[model samples]
Target: MAKEYTVTPWEVHGDVDYNEIVKEFGTKEIDDSLLKKIEKYGKLHHFLRRKHFFAHRDLDIILKDYDKGKKFYLYTGRSPSGPIHLGHMIPWMFTKWLQDTFDAPLLFQIPDEEKFLFKNNLTMEESEKWATDNILDIIALGFDHKKTSIFKNTEYAKTMYPVAVEISKRITLSKAKAVFGYTNETNIGSIFYTAMQSVPAFLPSIREGEPTNCLIPYAIDQDPHFRITRDVAPKLGYPKPASINCKFLPSLKGDSKMSSSINETCIYAGDSPEEVSSKIRKYAFSGGRDTLKEHRKKGGNPNIDVAYQWLTYFEEDDKKLEQVYHAYKSGELLSGELKEICIETINKFLSTHQKARAKAESKVEKFMLRD
Candidate 1:
């Protein structure tokens, strides 16, 4: 006879205080010294001057090497789980800027194997399509084809199995479990996912037979993965991959991170201008109260308002953003007017990306497959 299963109300329904999670894991602030250095290095435009990308490890060492004319490469990847959302763009765009500013070689990988393992029901054809779309979107972010290389794990695994095997051998199961929160109940494939990700960090050097170091710019949530990579780096005969942790880009619905699973929570790079406007208008959480009278007396809460924060990143014109902030604070502009600014800003941003994405789709494969 089959075993019986039981369910409880707590299992079916429960609420987590995500705000506490954000406070614990997401609070980051930048220093004046770093900002000065960024401006001096002509990186002010390249990097977002926000508190989110403040925490880092061994970044100063990379900067020292860069100062001495030593080359440092970039490594960042995506699992190809779904359509690439705005959250996905954070690292890619930042990497592109870093590559352009420092003239560093970059490796962008599509973790097809990991995606396949995690999402077992997804077909190979579907994986390929997602990878293709993601590559197009990434390339549209202004990565040079000659300077950037992309790897698809499923395709490369055939040729690079020996390297993968060697990497897997060096990482103990105990270490993997500790680093990734894996338990006995975790899938065997999930246990080895870290090795799959680590190999690409050392690939440029492996392929060239030269000493190589890498800098990964990624969201803070992904720091755990690279912490494992950094620990296993020396055992694999390479320098530990260094990383700069970026803050999570909040969702339209005010979550800490935007997820592709949530339809109304994010605006994608591929969204039509009209779609972009509609989503912002309909779903953007308002900081003001329902009554005009109460809103005029209380003033808007800039800290919790999604529209204001979106402007901080999207609105290039500082004067306009300042005007909106002042108006909202003084009750001169209502929530609808503020959302219009966000919609217009987002539409303009997406329009530029769409044109580039069209050209990118045709050439992205060749760029990824390059030697």
Candidate 2:
């Protein structure tokens, strides 16, 4: 039997069964028909082609609206408790594709207050500091400054609070508890945080003075939060927000998603080449046989190899990736060779990213959303 897994807004554990998750979450799997429709708008992003983004809710309705010349905005967020890691960037990369393909505006929310309330050791000041640090990396992803509006919850409270109160009015305590697993011991601020999260989904509609569609591209762990947003949208006189959820990018240890709390397993945006190389070679799990001779005879299993898994996210060329996959499986490439490839690819990507990140420091104000 499969080991029991837990996936929630606060934690992820075990080897997550994605297929089982799709079933449990009641979300539709993305099929060939949907791929064709998306490819019609723009080259379907490689993440979609690779099935990294695997499921959806009300996506068809968003496409239908686009066909009818109605526009939808994109919404996604970061909770600022720590530094941003590679795993956190996966969905944002896909979100950028959605913005470009559909010519949509984006509202990038930094919910520092939520982290402050939920994290026992975190203070509001530290959360706020991390919020600024995170914004630089978000800008480094090259979101359009004119079209993208990034804001922190505390900084934008004047605008966000009124809408949150309106949304909270529509949600009952029992409903929030049932959805979020809030206990009697749970702080009241955490209970009310969901209402703040729901506000961005409808902000576009409120701003335009007419109902507008919004698309949230997020990790599947976040499905529960958006489930609440979809429920409250219409009652607040807005269109239900649509969403597409993706799987977690596994950690170097291959147990669960890459977590910032696990320093050795994560590759942060600011990590130097030396730090990245050491982490991959030292801690990345291997799928090789016990001996080199055995590996040569029976071959390595790229299926569970952490290096190969991380390669899938960075390597854009389909043919190149398949060649590496085949070579590793045939023992033509060694486990060390696979790690070298992942290391080189990531370092190359980050070398360019670090330069952009430095430039991003001066440009934060241009993209910030202000009341």
Q: How well is each residue in 109-185 modelled by candidate 2, as lDDT tens digits?
A: 99989888988999999998899999999999988898899998888999999999999999999999888898999
Q: Best by lDDT, which number? A: 2
Per-residue CA lDDT of candidate 1, range 1-371, in tens?
33232111101112223333234443233456756765666746423565546655676677777788878999888878678887788778778878988888888878876766666587768888888778888888889888888888877776456777878888888887666667677789877777777777778778778768788887666666677777777886787777766655678887666767788988988898888888888988888767888778877866678888788777767687788888888777888888988888888878888899888868866677532
Error of 2 at 312 (Å): 0.7
Stretches off by above 4 angstroms in model 2 are 1-3
Instruction: Choose the strongest candidate by TM-score.
Output: 2
Each candidate's TM vs. the true structure?
0.88, 0.98
For model 1, where is the 10-residue window of minimal lDDT? Answer: 5-14
lDDT for each of the candidates? 0.73, 0.91
Candidate 2 backbone collisions, by pair: none
CA error at residue 356 for candidate 1, angstroms? 0.8
